[model samples]
Target: MNPSTFTVMEGEDNERIDQRLARDMDVSRTAIQQWITSGDVQVNGKEIKSNYKCRTGDIIEVVPPPEASPLTAQPEAIPLDIRYEDDDVLVVNKERGMVVHPAAGHASGTLVNALLHHTDALSDVNGALRPGIVHRLDKDTSGLIVVAKTNDAHEHLAKQLQTRSLTRLYIALVHGNVSHDEGTIEAPIGRDQQQRQKMAVTNVNAKEAVTHFSVLERFSEHTLVRCRLETGRTHQIRVHMTYIGHSLVADPKYGRSRSSPLAGQALHAETLAFIHPRQQEKRTLTASLPADMQALLDNLRSG
Candidate 1:
């Protein structure tokens, strides 16, 4: 097993060892505790319990166990809109209403299943659930996503995401007329404790998220806008827009009561740019707004 090391900083002082490790390593606290029980975690060259309070300037080492066998997900013959492809990566213009990968309730007919059928190999860095998936678009949001063909490619793409070098832009039709031409939303996002399925701007275990947007067009009750993500967070644009009193036109999770002509959120990932892992070159790809979104704009223009 490849052992990892970390040093507890002053900001992390007094935190439980397991919690500190979980936050720093982006792993589960339960998993860290398990490693502690197995004597695979040490602080200053001595094994410690999970509940031990960490002090600043402490050196920590973790030797994680070997990963379990990869889970098997059957490949399906679902159609994919391939935008670009090469040996190390593939860019797909995913359609709206298509789940990006498999989950407990959605175990089939996902983009992963389709990709498995289309390609013979995929990076397993994200484990079985999301092989080759460097990032994701919501099921209702359509647009470009890049898939990694090998582990090295996956790591490179993931580093771009972490460094905020990966560029993602979206086009959305939101409820209400936006007054400003452009603005930025800077908020921390975390899961809602009351409603586990929802995310909110909360301080508790929240991560910093920033979204910049510009108004493209205005209508009587809606506005078309372009958004660029500075820091990717789940449902960030949707949540931020809603927080600013301009939820998406048809976002069932965050929109007003009036049903929309479109079935889901009128949001599309319009552009994606990233540095290629193998080629060491920058690549930017774009996808046009889906037919439904375009039709909605046309209707607004005609009226």
Candidate 2:
């Protein structure tokens, strides 16, 4: 790309050159500063510091460097618990604390990193960082998640999820005793207005969320439940359970616990059923509760 020229409009006068260029060119101020340091940005045909204030009618030229790729998702030698794998799909019992894909601040030790190490045949429909990820399991919640080996498989599995044909079942330990044996929670979930890190049941920019739960066991103060999801919203089960006054045990964001032995929410993806993308056959897979959650239950029963 050629150098872009800009004239400092009246309102932008006296603004920092880096800020002005970033706003005008719709690039990051960090990139603008990099251009300034590299002598790619000029004011009135002379290179100037990023802090230089712009004046009205000042001519600025910017030659942006080639767009740098963000951090690459590296393939790590992390072992994956493969539940099922074939030509078109792979299903893995994602363990607790394993992130499903690479993202900001969670670049490594993710399932994607391990998947990359295991196979390079991941579908790129979700882009490089999230290759083959048809859906995601929350970092703290462990369980079965499907990955696509090809773009066609990716689209097929994604359509199943959208149409609610991809069935996902979870085992959740909640804070309070659930009175009913089985019930359905249908609520709208959205990002919490006050708490940026939390999702809440609200109508503001929310999506329809549904969770069907049946009591599996009951303890003195907690209840173990089996939950099936009909919609895959972010934090759907966690938010819906909390909305029904049965927040997951040890859920850092939703539960009231300040300290607990568990690493994260007492929830796990126990079962997953989806049609095989290539074979067109129904596939159902399941995994038992993780050790930590199991230990918690044992202690509760013993007490």
Candidate 3:
């Protein structure tokens, strides 16, 4: 077992032991709490829970295993389109069909596996299955994603997401020309009672979800639009778009009919913005439409 120790300094009194340990030790609050639960943390030589109030001159110790395995991480040489990289964060333009991380059947060739092969360390806030993942896009929906490399960065970014301070924008192609040039969808999203696998805009076990959109281009049978997310939920844009009379052009399950010739949902994550976790500066990034999506748009424009 590898052991680590930390000393509480002046001005740290009155803070919760777990919180302070998370900040000072560069580990997740959950990780620190786990140590406390296992009697791996002590205050003034006495084992205590994470909620214990910390005082100055307190001595804390933690014992961790020598190595941590990425539960489903397999080293794959999959090429990644890294948009930006810094000491604390990495921005990636994930292609369609690539799972963000491993699940039951998808244990290999995932983005997490790629990350494990590329980088040496990642934050453990979400658990072994998701290392450094701040947010996620659907498997078929491709676009910008931000990953945190350290616990400090993870905490900061997670807080931003919780407070809805992060900006996420997407572009999509939909069937039919929408009547409204721009509008907002203010609906509560919850699990579908009838279809357990999907989300719906109803009050049953629901949370608030908001999306703002503006039409960008119009064709004979399709329209392109830019969308911004105010509240991120599972299938917010997809469900809301379908609810608002313009289901994205290739969504199989929600729309009136599955697309015959078009590819999977025409949505793409086009923009992302947030405060830098370590640098504390505002950061904004954008990704152009993927080739297949652009080709479809071109065909729609010409026809």
- CA shift at 29, candidate 3, in angstroms? 16
Which ten residues in a row are the worst by lDDT in model 3? 64-73
lDDT assessment of candidate 1? 0.86
Cα lDDT computed for each candidate against the true fold: 0.86, 0.86, 0.82
Per-residue lDDT of candidate 2, residues 67-173 (tens digit): 52133578999988998999899999999999887654675899989999999899987556678988888899998999999999999999999999999999999
| Candidate 3 vs. true structure, TM-score | 0.76
TM-score of each: 0.78, 0.78, 0.76
lDDT of 3 by residue, 1-303 (tens): 467787878987889887887787777775666566445576666557566887888888876534312234566788899999988999999998888887545668889888878787788776666788878898778899999999999999989989989999999998888889999999998778798568889986678899999999999887899999998888899999999888988887677675445457888999999999877899999999998899988887778
* Model 2 CA deviation exceeding 4 Å by range: 1-69
Taking the candidates one at a time, how many backbone clashes does each contain? 0, 0, 0
Q: Which regions of candidate 3 are displaced past 4 Å?
A: 1-71, 260-262
- Residue 66, candidate 1: alpha-carbon lDDT: 78
By the TM-score metric, which is better: model 2 or model 3? 2
TM-score of 2: 0.78
